[model samples]
Target: MVRILQQKQFVGHEIHGKSHKYYPLITKETYTKSFMKGFVRRYFSGSYRQMVSFFTKEDNLSLHELEQLLKELKDKNS
Candidate 1:
């Protein structure tokens, strides 16, 4: 079965060869800064609280990782 993570752009395809492994790669276009903003908009409502809410509900995000992402977003906007 193929699983699709709506926010995380990807198709989880299986490897035909031995030692099968999968990774999430962006769908459509390359995930540049502009693309990320759109991703954030859809997933986080372009707000800090929204981002927190997203991870809380999804229960798969790490706090430290979110903090780092927040810092990066801030740096980009500033």
Candidate 2:
């Protein structure tokens, strides 16, 4: 895990005696956005609409949830 993190430049750590402490080089939101961008690209052909449509068709979201998503999109566009 540490090796992978180091390879990605995603963390820095210090070794003391026999122990190590690690810290994140990137913020959680930044990492989440980066992960989601790759996921959407791979699974949805880079289309957020396709991703949302898949979720919607799965019947996983309630009416209120759908409305909230619509409102958020509207606000973002505005």
The regions of model 2 sitting more than 4 angstroms off are none
Candidate of highest lDDT: 2
Candidate 1 structure quality by residue, lDDT tens digits, 1-78: 335443355545456777556666664555566677787788877776776776767977778877898899999999
Candidate 2's displacement at residue 40, Å, is: 0.5
Looking at model 2, which ten-residue stretch has the lowest summed lDDT?
Answer: 55-64
Error of 2 at 35 (Å): 0.7
The TM-scores of all predictions, comma-separated, are: 0.35, 0.89
Q: Looking at candidate 1, what is the lDDT of residue 49?
A: 74
Model 2: colliding residue pairs = none
What C-alpha lDDT values do all the predictions have? 0.69, 0.94
RMSD of 2: 1.2
